[model samples]
Target: MSGRPPGAKSVDQLLEEARSRITRVTPEDAVSRMADGAVLVDIRPQSQREADGEVPGALVVERNHLEWRFDPESDARLPQATGYDVDVVVLCQEGYTSSLAADALRSLGLTRAGDVVGGHRAWVAAGLPTTGGPAT
Candidate 1:
């Protein structure tokens, strides 16, 4: 007995589904992967990144164009979208959106894609390398 659109999954359900499909990394772990040549992609909008600060080497790919820019067969793909085996770590202001983005990337055949747990905020907290970013 709810006044709502049919077949609309709640955000909670969506989050659960997304997280189940990916192994999210901690901020420290993310930095470790970076050392090993993984790509840390920050999907937070420009405004948020400017406001909070940024991870120095993290690529700002934004959320909307991720699929196209990361798809191996797409012309819009970024140079870092090297191949299907590349480790792509998605990040946002928090962990939530990155989970969804990681899942999306996986669906696009980026099997190694994942997210940074707690996002940039956690990155800052762990004393990882970032520039002009959030105050942890």
Candidate 2:
């Protein structure tokens, strides 16, 4: 049997859908948003994060726990607890996962949720600063 369910689209289709639903921003736009107080959520796994470094002020939240922590009703694990109303931008190793993560946030009622267009790769490619380890 194939991995796809009945009536389900292929990975390409899913990606296209995610792209349509997601609001993409460049690293420069992301910088402006961060300066203006938007929360940048890094959803890349800990291992990848360590290897690739991180954006200077990004919040490290594993992808699995993101919805609960940012949902407002639930007590957030992070020091900075945020509600769904917060302006949030999700990032991953590449642009793909961020779009999915951003869509999930929107489902949780974050109207302003979005993702970095090219994620950390693009950020690094654009010459943005990255921290050596997990954010403190």
Per lDDT, the best of the predicted structures is: 1
Q: Give the alpha carbon lDDT tens digit for every residue of 13-69 in model 2.
A: 877887787688998899899999889999999899888897889998989998888
- List the candidate 1 regions with Cα displacement exceeding 4 Å: 134-136
Query: Where's the lowest-lDDT run of ten residues in candidate 2?
Result: 76-85
Pairs in steric clash, model 2? none
For model 1, how does the per-residue alpha-carbon lDDT over 74-126 read when each residue is reduced to its tens digit?
Answer: 99999998889889999998899999999999999999999999998898878
- Candidate-wise lDDT, in order: 0.91, 0.84
Summed backbone clashes in each candidate are 4, 0
Error of 2 at 3 (Å): 8.7
RMSD of 2: 3.3
lDDT of 2 at 131: 80
